[model samples]
Target: MPVPRPFPPRPFHGWRVVQAAFVLAIFAWGIGFYGVGLYIQTLSASRAWPVAWLSAAVTFHFLVSAGLVALLPDWHRRFGIAAVTRAGALASALGLLGWGWAPHPWLLAPAAALTGVGWALCSGAAINAMLMPWFDRRRPAALAMAYNGASIGGIAMTPFWAWLIAGWGFGAATAVVAALLLAVVWPLAGLVLGRSPAEFGQHADGEAAARPPPAVAPAAARDRAALLRDARFIGLSAAFAIGLFAQMGLVTHLVSLLAPVLGVQGAGFAVSLVTVFALLGRTVTGWLLPQGEKRRLAAAATFVTQVAGSLALLLGGDQAWLLLLGCALFGIGVGNLLSLPPLIVQAEFPPAEVGRVVALMQAINQALYALAPLGFGLMRDVGSTAAAIGLALALQVLAGILVLRRPAP
Candidate 1:
């Protein structure tokens, strides 16, 4: 009998990177994104800050972060992902602590801005840049697994912070959360985000044997100005800008919207449910969909769901079931909002240009979404929750239409 050849080992390292990215996503979104609503509430109660002012600070946070994110490609090339993430972790920790302990309300803007810096480094843009090189054939699955951390963050941390703030006060609760963030994120950034697969003599998806790298087309030498002139980029940016504006606006106000009707604990539960459905939606899409034209369709469908959810919220009144249902439906597309934009860019753009394109897209998306909270808060201040939510629903409907437009072949 002929001797059997030895089987090669599976590539496990890439998965390690995925795992670390998952943890990083949890911290980044949990503390920076979902936690914003809680901060607004706490500051409103403790410091008597108006909702609009607090919401504006949140907008400022995103504006600054968008500028930082626009520079991510150059930053990664110069300093590497690990260094970038490390700086982000430290900044996030310090910012959180500052936010918790600020004696005067005036300090909140700067603190929020600092936290924004951390967010830019740890957000989806950073996650995509880190994981893209490690995954190809499995890119969808890897991204789904990592981005789901955002949902998990909402599920786990929202209630945890709500409870912690209730029990220990905002200052103590925030400090503890910040400490935990540093403890978890610093080590992971150091250990797994240090290098890409190629740097360690591996290929994407951890292929067991070495093979010649695939030939890549030389990226267009056009600068950001030329890229801005591209029709496809403009279409993608406008679609997502409107979509995220509605989504983020609703999310920022979700807890407050439900609190009067559902009570604080009930509102927290609704937010968690939204996140649970978001996780489910992203996970299901990853398993069911292929990686190309279908992405836009999926994203468009999700936007429609958000529109329906917003309408439900507008009409639900004080009915707990309707509110919960609205949150669940709205959440069906939440995770996809973050995941699809990058995937679409990957599909439409050249591999060499993916980083810059993704960065620019993120910047525009952030800039527009940054206004969501301020606008929503202003509406809430001047009108009823239903009216504010109705405006958001309209925005989502418009976004859905924008995204549904078929691209030229």
Candidate 2:
């Protein structure tokens, strides 16, 4: 009663890392991912280049990023996170400048490739790796929170790029954003990414002492070669690849599909709605996700929900409400699709192997989904929006089944 209250515990430094990672996701997806669309449109109009050629360059960009993403763990281990992140920031800045300044059509190739290298280092796998050493039991929530930056990136960057390009022209706008990226990322790398839990003399999730690692499958593989042979790894990779392929395809085509029903502005709003729900979905899942195991089940359930959304869109036809409803349902699972994989890896694989496993899976997933726009476009041209959406639904269903499957003990 009369005694003085004890001091409150110190704030977790890992939360600062989470904040840094969040900012990294914003820039990573904002420029590296969503910025591709801006490059495609601006370059095509300004250079009078063929849309197909520019699109091919974008595809190449993603492919290069996918290839390099597989090597990120090795790079991180060799170079350290701060060094690698700062290097990526420099590369990305230069690449953006290249995107705006490159005069000839063929010049886009090298520019795209350079951007891809930067993208791989800053992308989801890197985000997962950054957080892994600092978080354990609470990682689901941590990842969910961190990955929300991606959705935010899409929401913020699209309009920002458009406005800047309109006023300053593409080259000037690109230069300004690139400089901004460097200013923000350099300090972040030094301040947050460079350090670790042990360095801070703290435990993950702010525990007083370090906890024992969770139980992993006896069949879990320790090395990349062994992981390639593991059934669990295969299943996880396949599930995510299939789901993402469908998702990217649908999202790429969504605006055109809805334009007739909702007009361009309305369709844009729908896409923004999807991003909002994606952020909301991930936040809820992070809070509710069980401590260990069941992550696969949660992932499967996400795909199933997406499958329903696909069905609703397939049937929505001229009904705007129904289409909007489909978008909300589909969007609810979008963030989970990206955030759950690393969590699943953490649950099923050894801690030491988490970075490698996540990297490889991300690479595979990115490589496959890079084709979604073209694949879904072909489906739309060959048939109709319904046809494309139907294919997405089928893929989501397959993903659900695959995620639920486990290899024999």
lDDT of 2 by residue, 1-409 (tens): 6999998766888889888989988998988888898888898888798989988988998999999998899999999999999988888899899889988888889888888988999989999988988888889888988899999999998999999999999999989999999999999999998898877689988999976655754445477788889999999899999999999889878888888999999999999989999999999999899755688888988998898888889899899999999999899888899999998888887677889999999999999999999999898889987889999999999999999998852
Q: Candidate 2 lDDT (Cα, whole model)?
A: 0.89
Clashing pairs for predicted structure model 2, backbone only = none
**Can you tell me which runs of candidate 1 are displaced by over 4 Å?**
1-10, 209-216, 381-384, 406-409
Q: Tell me the spans in candidate 2 whose CA falls farther than 4 Å from its real position.
A: 1-10, 212-221
The model with the greatest TM-score is 2
Q: List all candidate RMSDs to the true structure.
A: 2.8, 2.8
Candidate of highest lDDT: 2
- In candidate 1, what are the lDDT values of residues 1-409, reduced to their tens digit? 9999997754578889988999899889988898887898899998898877787777787888998998898899999889999999888888888789988877888899889999998988999998888887678888889999888788788779989999999999989998998888888887898777766778877886655656864656556888898887888889888888888888877888999999988997888788899999888877675677777888888898888888889899978999899999999878788888888777777778888888889999998888887788789889877788988888888877877675572
The CA lDDT at 71 in model 1 is: 89
Q: What lDDT does the true structure give each of the candidates?
A: 0.85, 0.89
Score every model by TM-score.
0.91, 0.95
lDDT of 2 at 262: 95
Candidate 2 lDDT score at position 404: 92
Q: Local error of candidate 1 at 373, Å?
A: 1.8
